[model samples]
Target: MDASVIVAGAGPAGLMLAAELRIAGADVIVVERLPERTGESRGLGFTARTMEVFDQRGLLPRFGEVETSNVGHFGGLPVDFGVLEGAHQAAKTIPQSVTETILEQWAAELGADIRREHELLSLREDGEGVEIEVSTPEGRRTLRASYLVGCDGGRSTVRKAAGFDFPGTAATMEMYLADLRGVELEPRMIGETVPGGMVMVGPLPGGITRIIVCERGNPPQRRTEPPAFQEVADAWKRLTGIDISHAEPVWVSAFGDATRQVTEYRRGRVLLAGDAAHIHLPAGGQGMNTSIQDSVNLGWKLGAVVRGTAPETLLDTYHGERHPVGRRLLMNTRAQGLLFLSGEEMQPLREVFSELIRYEEVSRHLAAMVSGLEIHYDVGSGTHPLLGLRMPRLELSADGRRTSSTELLHRGRGVLLDLEDNAVLRRRAAGWTDRIEVVTAAPAGAAPGGPLEGTAAVLVRPDGHVAWAAPGSHHDLPTALERWFGPAR
Candidate 1:
């Protein structure tokens, strides 16, 4: 095989998956159609869950000082992200282009072979492996890998080539997004519903202002290229009665509220991630953030399977876990589109939603949903509150030094955290030491009534989700171990 994995598209998902596969000691090759980075900032920043994912991987410092905010939105309504408890706030201004550059560099440093201007032409999967034909700058070549993952945006060629069943609503209306210079506008950070439709203006770095205009009654158009800046300006004028035609246009694009999700995330040896698996309205900037999280969820499992550390059934959990998340994403984005993009007919429901959001519980629920803090996987039959949830950042004292649960995950391996230093627990997990790290540590000032209050030991998956917890889990240590890490040696 040329590589263990071949990832299509060098966007956030593909780069991140490549990096993760390399971390797990699997060979990876990433093919991107673009010759160079576009520098287009379609996605501004990542959600809080993505922030934690990056932090656990020790990739945050590479981004330099990131700007974070507790202020966010649900549809067009305001919500305080501070309502959710997390170690990091949602990063607000790091452009998607910057994110891609950082991830591409990191993946390359990890020895992932990234080929630019190489477009995938076709793919075939059989009992042995997957073979992909691609058009490269040199010539057409065929590459074979144990698995292939598609991260190639909404209109994914791999999705179609593999014949994955994608069924959902089609586009009904169009919206414009433009980045402009030589223009000053009040920051409508969330958005404002005008007489015609909704319009949003926010400041970007480098003296650029970003605007989104969704004019009611504008039909969705099929186009090969980006829309003109004048088209966006005209929509803005129609919505807000403002004429910014004189402003210098940086870039302009059009999008729609078409929602979709594949019936399954995996098809034999060909799996899907990011926009290839799902698509939704770009509400609350969830598109790119969710795509990144999808890669994080799939990366380690696929890597483990390819490396023979785990059975191939482990890959099935990827679809089982992320497909639900994608379904919910489509649901929420479509709901948001109805709330924010509809005509006056939606005002009553919007008013009702506004009133409902006044309650802290409602706001918290919406905030958690939008920020991706609400995700929890079904690890097993466990009563622990954090059993299926993400393992919260916990301070630890191991070998007379300060470390953290987050720090232990930097190696991209499963963690058997022995909080009470139980020798028997370590012995029980001994067989899987090669596949997981067993750390005996004492909690440093753990809160009395916190999520870890009664937990003696916890098993954390490589993706940061808690697979098992002591004092609550029904299954024994080795049972849970074999379930996630394959049969012990």
Candidate 2:
């Protein structure tokens, strides 16, 4: 394919999308501004939802080695995401560097030209594609791509050059952070008493502890702004009752919880994603997780458009589906701040949750919110069972071997399960051998290992969402195929 996608940031979102596009047979180029990996790692963990997306592509084991989990909650309260109503059951704590490294490696394997120390200086969209101006070590050069994506953090030069408006409020409250050594703090345990203001200390995999100090009236500071290490250390001791007076500092920075989202995530042929698209408080470890998922959600649609198999409207769905998710992300993070900031005066609210914890539903919902597994869309397909729902990662049986639904998608193709091998079902996938892979799932209840009930012959999209499915149907198959696979064979 002569057409190429120029991705402006090498962060998780950009890298993930680049990998997806390359895997789908597109020429992809990823650009990063940093000359080298920053020893200072931010976005220290990913929710189970993010891990599930990776696991589907056989990318989990690559990242899981450096990851730690069994982490229970935020602030001082306990979290139980395993009870959330979905396939993703656990959260994994991994450094942003490791996450970026895994994605970079994956993209490289797919033959994406990932260039570092090359910053996006300017860009213009024409009828043919987008022409991006870059400033590299070799001086400046212009590159053309059929599409351009800005994953270049909150301050994206691509978005700015394209004249997109990022509308949102700046932070009013500020928090300081310090990654220190010689500090002894349990990774999972955080104080439940951090009302109005709170401090949290958690273990990052490398024996390094992360300390976050937030206060109600503290002045907001840019992330680049440095805070006094001793002051943060003293405050940590006061809040957690742990003295880390002699801990050697690794990295210290301050930031605000102020949140803002772009009014529109896309501007013409160039799109904004990840931190480049939306940023909010660091609450709930969502900052990075949401961005990675955004590209996953859009990657396939972009690929299909480039491949000439999907309508132009498909690309628009990236903004349609993702913008609302971004809105929810902003709101969810704000609510998390309240929980972390609740003081003695807010004791009643805690008492309510503590009391409500007995009811499994409330805890399950909150857990779902944090994990981001609870997201569902408006099903624009004129009403279908699986239209707006995520596919349940289930184990299925084939000619003899046991396999997970994710296994089939590792090669990045759509799957059509034929439950009974019904003649009509067999004929439904007659054409498009190049686009869809057909597989016959075992008879109804006989599927293997953790199969969700009421699923028979599922149609999995390239991005892993369930495009069309049937609980029990021999005749409804054709209609499902048309809407999802774009007027099937």
Candidate 3:
């Protein structure tokens, strides 16, 4: 086999998956159609949960001076995220190009083979494995792998070739996005509605301003060529009475509110993640964040399977877990589209939503939804309140040294955190020590009623979700271990 896994596209999801497979000691190859990085960024920031995910891998420092914000919005209505517990504000200004660069470098440092100018032409998945045909700069070639993953954006060649069902509502409206210089305008960070449509203008680094123009009554069009800058400037003038024709355009593109998701994330040896699995309106800046997370959730499980450390059934969990999240993603983005993009007909709904958002419960729920903190998988039947949830950040004292739950996960290994030093619990999980790390720790500087107050111990999956907890839980530790980390050695 050319590699244990072949990942199509070198965007954030594909590069992240490659790094994850390498972390699990599996050979991975990443193929990208682009010969070089575009340096143009459509996604401007990431959700709070993505920040924590990057922290778990010791990748925060790579970005160099990140700006986080406690303030955010849902459908252009203000909703503070500070109300949620353990929520670090979302990263405000990191560009998608920078994110891709970081992931590509990290994956390369981890020994992932990344090939540029390699376009996937065809793929065939049989009973044994998947074979792919690719067109390189020199010529066409065939590559084999145990599995193939598509991260090639909304129009996925792998998803199409593998016959994955992508069903959803088509685009009803289209908008223009441009990043350019030589123009200065009042900041419309949360977007502003005008007579005929809406417009948003925000400043980026290097004197460039990002503008989004959404002219109402403009139908969605399937165009092979990008919209000209003059068209965008004309729309801006018609909508908001602003003339941006003098601005020098750096990058220009168009998008639509076309919502869709794959019926299945995997079909035999071929799988999907990121935009390949889901696509929706770029509301609340959740598209790229969700795509990045899809890779994280699938990476460890696929790595385990390829390394022969876990059963193939574990792979099924990727679909079982993420497909629902993708469904929710589509739902939320569609709701936001109605709230933010529709005409005056949606004003009442927006008013009701705004009033409801004033309530702390409503604010917390919406904050968690957009920030991705509300994601909880059905790991098992347990009422520990922490089960199937991403493990909260905690300060721990281990061997007279201070560490954090996030630090323990830097190695990308499952963690059995024994908070009370239970010998029985430690012994119960000893058989899986080779695959899981056992860290005896206790709360350090924790308040009386903190999130982990009643927890005696917790088994955290490699992806940072709680697999099992000891307090007020009936599932045995050994059973939980066997279910997640594979059978005991």
Candidate 4:
């Protein structure tokens, strides 16, 4: 095989997956049609969960003084994202272009082969691997790999070529987004509705501002090129009575509320990630965040399979896990569109929502949903609270040394943390030492009676989710190891 995996597109998801695969000791190649990075950014920042994902790999310092906020909105309604304290706040200022550049650099530094100006033309999958044809700067060439993943956006060629069923709602309205340099506007971080429609304006770095306009009675339309700046300015005036045609346009584009998701994330040897697996209204800035999380989840699993450390069936978990998350993403974004973009008739629903959000429990629930902290997978049968949930951040002291749970995951290896340091438990896990890391430590400071209160030993996946917890075990350590890491070496 030319490489263990071939990743299509150089967007955030593709770059992130390539970096992860490299960390897990897999040969990866990333192909992108664009000759260079597009400075335009559709997503302004990432969610808190995505922040943790980056922090797991020690990639945050590279961004240099990230600006974050605990204050956010849910469908134009004010909501505080600080319900969970001591967690990373939502990054609010970094542009998507900067995110892509960082991930591309990270992936390249890890020895991932990235090919620019190389476009995937076609792909055919057999029982063993996938063969792909690409149009490159040199000429057309065929490349073979054990697996292929498409991160090429909503209109994914890999999803189409592989015959995956994309079933969901279609676009109904078109909205304009533009970044300007010569205009100074009031900050509408969420959005505001007028008699006609809604408009949003927020300041950015480098004396620039971003604006979004949704005009009433405008239907979604297809165009070969992006809408002109004047069109966006006109829509702004119609919605907010603001005619700032003098604002020098930096980037202009249009989008829709159409939502869609594939029935499955994997098909034989071909797989999908990012917008290829799911697309929805960019509500709560969840599109890019969800896409990045998807790549992180799939990266380690794919790497294990390619390196012959795990069974091929492990790849099936990617679909079983992320498909449901994608479905919920579509559901929540469609609900938000109704609340944020609908006509006056939605005022009553908005009022009801506003009233509901006043309760502390309601606020916390909504905040977790938008921040991606409430995700719980069904890893297996166990009553432990930490089971299938993200391993909460905790301080530990091992052999008089200090460390945190997040720091241990920087190397992209499964962690079997033994709080009691049982000799029998360590002996049982010795066979999988090559694939998993064993750490013996006790909680530091006043450890609360939370998920790890009574746990004696905990097993965490490379993606940061707790796969197994000890206290009461039905399957035992050996069984959990086999279920996640594969048969003992």
lDDT per model, in order?
0.91, 0.74, 0.90, 0.90
- The sequence of per-residue lDDT tens digits that candidate 4 reaches over residues 348-388 is 99999889988888888988888888889878888888888
- In model 2, the worst 10-residue window by lDDT is 443-452
Q: Give the winner by lDDT.
A: 1
TM per candidate? 0.99, 0.90, 0.98, 0.98
lDDT of 1 by residue, 1-489 (tens): 999999999999899999989988899999999999898989998889899999999999999999999988887988888878754799988999999999999999999999998999999999999999999889999999999999998999999999999999899998988889999998885548889888889998899999998888899999899998888888888878889999998888899989999999998899999999998999988988889889988988998899898999999999999999999999888888888888789989989998999999998999889888999998998788888999999898998999999999999999999988899999999999998999988888877887777689999999999999998999999999999999998
Off by over 4 Å in 1: none
Per-residue alpha-carbon lDDT of candidate 2 for residues 298-393, written as tens digits (9 for 90 to 100)? 787788777767665777778988999999889877766766675676667766766776566876777777777777765444334565566666
Which run of 10 residues does model 4 get worst, by summed lDDT? 446-455
Q: Give the TM-score comparing model 1 with the true structure, all chains together.
A: 0.99
Give the alpha carbon lDDT tens digit for every residue of 303-327 in model 3: 8888887898898999999999999
Cα distance off (Å), candidate 2, residue 484: 4.2
User: What C-alpha lDDT does candidate 2 achieve relative to the native structure?
Assistant: 0.74
